[model samples]
Target: MTHTRRDVFLGLGAVGLLGACANGVGGRGGATIDARVDATLAQLYRDYPATRQLADKSAGLLVMPLVTEAGLGFGGGGGNGALRIGGATVDYYNMVKASGGLQIGVQQYSHVLFFMTDDALQTFRRSGGFAAGAGIAYATPQKGEALAAETTTSLAPVIAVIFGQSGLRVGATLEGVKYTRIIP
Candidate 1:
């Protein structure tokens, strides 16, 4: 099989489409991922109710706008999420530089993570400034979102806001992707 640049993108596109088949939840195996998203969001609201107040705080920092990329390379699953710190929603494709292995297949998932504290929130404020060290639990889920619980590198004044992603599977380290705000 001669895989040229075109073939590479074609494979990526196919995987991406399969992942996009669902709205990030309630599709095929999406039930699990969606359920996780909902539980996490509810817990986030309870844990960091203040984030609602700080939603307008994030700015200048990396804005990772929600993006849907179709790829058939290694992993095939589309999930959308937004993380707001200092009034700016910092999430999207280019914002979070991803660098890790991948898994490809037809799947759908959704999730949102809030940095529940001031220091942790600030860490991400810098352009590509998430001091994620080795074994620094990158992605986790609630119920199935992430049993490890929220990892607060430091206790800074902050809150977490998660919504509509109750069931999803996030690799220990899914790289190069981020969550950007969506202004309606």
Candidate 2:
């Protein structure tokens, strides 16, 4: 199949629109992001109490209040979040993802990354852009279900919990998601 220049521009435009749907995109800076993070954490703890145990043990937590994703053939997602340590927001970040495949729909969800070790947290902070990879452990617990932080999970450098998903998108994964520190 032959592609035209218009097709390329249209595809790029769609991806840009999808990325803009992310929460806190044009919000009131750090304060707004922090507020959302607080609420998201509260809801997570309420829905899955066992996560609190993980939170308590974590060296730091990156709470992405809401991420919006959309795709037809190519897809992209974006969200703003805050990194909290000792229950206080220390820095803000932006999470972005780009992918291509057979996909069609839009979805919004919240996710949290728990830094189980100080070294992991430091590495993330120092890196120009940290990308989620195979090394990270993912735990998706159904509502009211317990998140078992077994020996293996507890020992993992980073643990991710995704929840409060709503929309038509079939599945959510952190693969290829890149997180960068942002002033907001």
Candidate 3:
């Protein structure tokens, strides 16, 4: 009986170790990752240069941090993100399939969502529409790209995401991450 108990304990210990490294564990490591995210954001902005300005210009900035999920063959496109505006950081999650702009890789970085128009912001905030169609503009930096740029052609609102952005420059296919409005 003692031996069996010891084995069980050992198994649990292994699981605990695995959880620490894995995403969504929400334990000490998860908290650490969040802190790291903040620091990384600082670095990203510093390296990229235009990131902070874009965030500041947006009607609201939604930050999706360290989403560590496996995308088997389909949608792992969206995960939980935070919406920051008026000094409030609201928690949110994304549930989208890419149609136009994205990369096909395991992305584990935070996303900064930029809303370049008032209508998109208003719609996102008031009409409760976080889904694409009404208003919003976004762009994601590639996994290696240092900078992502957008030239807004539509006054109707746009959401262009610059995905797979690391400190490197690699272009990703256009696959939009779906973002649903999080009820505050």
lDDT, model 2: 0.83
For 1-184, candidate 1 gives per-residue lDDT tens digits of: 2345764676566654545444332243333433433454455445545433333342222212122333333333334434434533333322222232333323223334434445555555544434233322233324333222223323223322223332333333344544332222
User: lDDT order of candidates, best first?
Assistant: 2, 3, 1
Which is the winner by lDDT between candidate 1 and candidate 3? 3
Q: What TM-score goes with each of the models?
A: 0.39, 0.88, 0.53
TM-score-superior candidate, 2 or 3: 2
Alpha carbon deviation, residue 17, candidate 2 (Å): 1.0
TM-score of 2: 0.88
Q: Against the true structure, what is every candidate's RMSD?
A: 9.2, 2.8, 10.4
Work out candidate 1's RMSD over C-alphas.
9.2
Q: Which candidate has the top score in lDDT?
A: 2
> lDDT per prediction?
0.37, 0.83, 0.48
> Which residue runs of candidate 1 sit more than 4 Å off their true CA positions?
1-6, 15-40, 43-71, 74-79, 84-103, 126-175
lDDT of 2 by residue, 1-184 (tens): 3445654555466678966563564557888898899899999999998888888888999999988877655668888999999999998999988765555678889999999999999999999999998778888789978886555355589999999989996544323689999885
Q: Where does candidate 3 have its weakest 10-residue lDDT segment?
A: 68-77
Better by TM-score, candidate 3 or 1: 3
- Candidate order by TM-score, decreasing, is 2, 3, 1
